[model samples]
Target: MSSKINAALGREIRDSLREMRIQLSTLNHRVGSRLGLKDADLDCLDLINRAGPISPGALARRAGLHPATVTGILDRLERGGWVARERDPADRRAVVVRPVQERAADVLHLYAGMNRGIARICADYDEAELRVVADFLRRTAEAGRQATEEL
Candidate 1:
């Protein structure tokens, strides 16, 4: 591509990414409000749910949260019935967090509209296009992670 075209595309991509970030942040806040939880609490719940019974220390590392902060987040989640803490069988002294599946349906329902929108948008893409989009998203997410680490 010509330099002019490349620059224009870069500007457009950056603009879109900024807009997406703002929208996602708003959506997350709305979901958190619906569940009566803070964003950090919801983030911890999501991390625990995806990781499947992870140790608190591990969650803190993954989430870039202080262990003390994680403790408070877990306390709130536990109280809200969004997560449960259990003794790790392999290491009796260690505790692992698990998602409270029964409560997950309500949270999932809150995301249904967005999920449907994403599905509709994805339906317009063929396999090749989806692969490209997936690759772009994965790389973009990694870049975001790296940027956060710098801060």
Candidate 2:
């Protein structure tokens, strides 16, 4: 009886996880479109948010975009007033691009919810088990990124 119940719960969890991922992805597409972001804008922002105060050329390289494309994205971002470019004080010829707000407050709220939700899901796991799960996910993501590079 106990074994059957556990197996059923496991299946439920797996299906629910898949459904939630799909829902979140669809929601992201909808919300991003509403916000006037291109399908690729999220990746561009993520790259900039991770390593900003950098130049358009460098941002293009890191985001796997052409320099001209990066310039276009930057122009849109600047027009939206979400980003700013300033001449590097040291070089006076170099430009720095940075987010106007570091992890915007609304964005932080969403992060908090996501963090708590994931923590709650893993609350049953011990630290060692959690470590293994985290490592596995990281490795899986790395494999995915590598596969993209190969294409």
Candidate 3:
């Protein structure tokens, strides 16, 4: 009975995750379409913007993507003049990927708009109501960390 209960709970969790992803994805698609960038491309741009100049492999690790996938994304951004790869001066052997002039404002604005949109949405709710959602997500993420630690 306990095993069955656990199995049922697992399925419920899976369904909930799927629903959350679908809704979140729909929102991102709407935003990304307005901005004209691919989902994968956004992750790549964000890594450079957030992590400073990092090698392709390091960027992939930071973004939780494979190197080949990151390479393809960079290719698009490079061709669009949105990103540039430069040789690491200290490590002369390594090439670091970074956003060049063309993409800087666009890349930064993407995150800024999302934050502003979220803030605007949160404004509709009372502070107490917003706090519950924030606390729940934090706890859920912490629980995920604990689960991963056990493995």
Question: lDDT of candidate 1?
Answer: 0.93
Runs in model 3 lying further than 4 Å from the true structure: 1-20, 107-113, 121-151
Estimated TM-score for each candidate: 0.96, 0.69, 0.61
lDDT string for model 2 (1-151, tens) is: 6999999987996797689779777766765576677756656765777788888888887777889898888888788766789998778989988877843553445446567888898998999999998997788668767877887
Better of 1 and 3 by lDDT: 1
In candidate 1, what are the lDDT values of residues 1-151, reduced to their tens digit?
8999999999999999999999988999999998899999888888998996999999999899999999999999998888889999999999999999999898899999999999999999999999999999999999988999999
Best by TM-score: 1
Worst 10 residues of 2 by lDDT: 102-111
TM-score, model 2 to reference: 0.69
Writing each residue's lDDT as its tens digit, candidate 3 over 13-131 gives 77997898797687666655766778777667767877867899988876678789989989987887878899998898889987786667765575586679888999999989999
lDDT of each: 0.93, 0.76, 0.79
Worst 10 residues of 1 by lDDT: 43-52
What are the runs in model 2 whose C-alpha is more than 4 Å off?
1-24, 110-113
Looking at model 3, the pairs that clash are none
Better of 1 and 3 by TM-score: 1
